[model samples]
Target: MNTRIGTIFAQEFRLARRNLWVGLATGILGLFAVVLGVFGAGQGAALDADALTLTAASLATLSVYLIPLIALLMSYDSFAGEIERGALALTLASPVRRWEIFVGKFAAQSLAVGVAILLAFGAAGAFLALSFGTGSEGIAAWMRLMATAFVLGSVFVGFGLMLSAMAGRTATAAASAVGLWLVLVVIYDLALLGSVMAASDGIFASQVFPWLVVANPADAFRLFNLALIETAPVAGIDGLASTLPFPPTVALAVLGLWLSAVLALGIRRTKRIVP
Candidate 1:
């Protein structure tokens, strides 16, 4: 990392630490993790397949919504809010490159969210280990889930940053971020369900179903994490994975693409803003 970018990154981290909303949001997520972990411990022994499976499934389901929401809210103000408050002009007046500023902000926000996830899930894992001695298999599964979650959150951070760069007002950025979240997390699946029903046996369903799943980062994240469980049936996910044209590796690649494309576009968009 360039010295300038590193400075900006550190500054953003300090800002995030001081932000009351960021602290509150992380606390809520940590609370959820501890609660789920305790619930899983109560289900059976911590090492039990049923307990691990249930805990993973519940966490994956919750993350599909919560992670993205946190990512979006964390980043929706990155550029737009600064511009709205007239701070962006002053910041850009520095010797730093525009891309450095954008990249630094993105990295800081992503790291903040990742740390929150780790703290939350880590606490749960600790509780399980102390109380019931989590086995290697359970620990491994939890690690994989955590990785998928971090990737999922990065995807949305890129997406929300793009909106923040493009929108002229913080209000516009916030509204677009929330709307995009709803589309990707909720409406996308419902639309896919309708398509499946309409095309039942049509070639569209056969040929296009897998593409649809990978197109949405949330679905891809869900599929990637849920497919990791060796013994549990992950409700709506297993059926799709069985016929998924690509493997979990490909789903992860698609998410990587999403992050790259959105971040690149955001950088370019931010550079174009006159302020």
Candidate 2:
């Protein structure tokens, strides 16, 4: 099983690398890292240790959202594109089980995006080490940031694969993935914010907002990084501790749920394809 899955995953990764968006995202992430490092170095004198730690943590948190967007783009056409090109049927004619094909392909897609993020964070870590002269802690923090980014990315890529398996064409899959991403990562938060605003005087606003934030995978990733390694809680969420039970743990669990749900759906949907 391992050998079969590894073969398919290797092939899928090569195919994914040919996609223009994958390369473009990698380049953009590298550029962003360099630019962020330069900005941090330039502001070296103005900010102290605590402020620097906070800023780095905040930037790492932001990557939770940015990385997932790219991951979705990477896998949004995994199955649909092949079907559109009339190649999916031939590929399925092989001896591999559909579930293996689906899981292996999604794994490869997730790894490809993970590689991009790893490169970006590595560059950022080197920069911090050079500028701050405290490479130990900065490098450690970035390493955790990379792991968190990779896990968050897996959730998005799995969802994209599921969308691709369900859609009739690559275009439809792409549209649906983008729409879902926007809703989950942005609109959902905005809606929660609106609800909180409307109930400003109520207990729900003060008590339930943290739980609502956990529903957004991006926020969950941020909370995980901020609360755990950074030990710097999110700003302006003082009521969170009293309401949300184990915010970091819950966030991790929610992300795990998304990954499992999407991957399971993708595998089931792909198995049903006639090809």
What is the Cα-based lDDT of residue 248 in candidate 2? 68
Model 1 C-alpha lDDT per residue in residues 1-275, reported as the tens digit of each score: 99999998998888877885467666887788667767766756444564555576678878899999999998999889899899989988989899998899889988888888887777776666676665677777778888888888888988988899899689999999999999999999888878787885767776788788778899888877766665544556446765666777877888898989988998999889878
The superposed Cα distance between candidate 2 and the true structure at residue 53, in angstroms, equals 3.1
How many angstroms is residue 15 displaced in model 2 relative to the true structure, after the best TM-score fit?
1.8
What is the alpha-carbon lDDT of model 1 when measured against the actual structure? 0.81
lDDT of 1 at 30: 72
In order, the Cα lDDT scores of the candidates are 0.81, 0.74
Best by lDDT: 1
What are the clashing pairs of model 2? none
Best of the candidates, TM-score: 1
Clash pairs for candidate 1: none
> For model 2, how does the per-residue alpha-carbon lDDT over 114-205 read when each residue is reduced to its tens digit?
88877766666666666656545555666667787889988898988889989959999989998988898778877887788788576776
Worst 10 residues of 1 by lDDT: 45-54
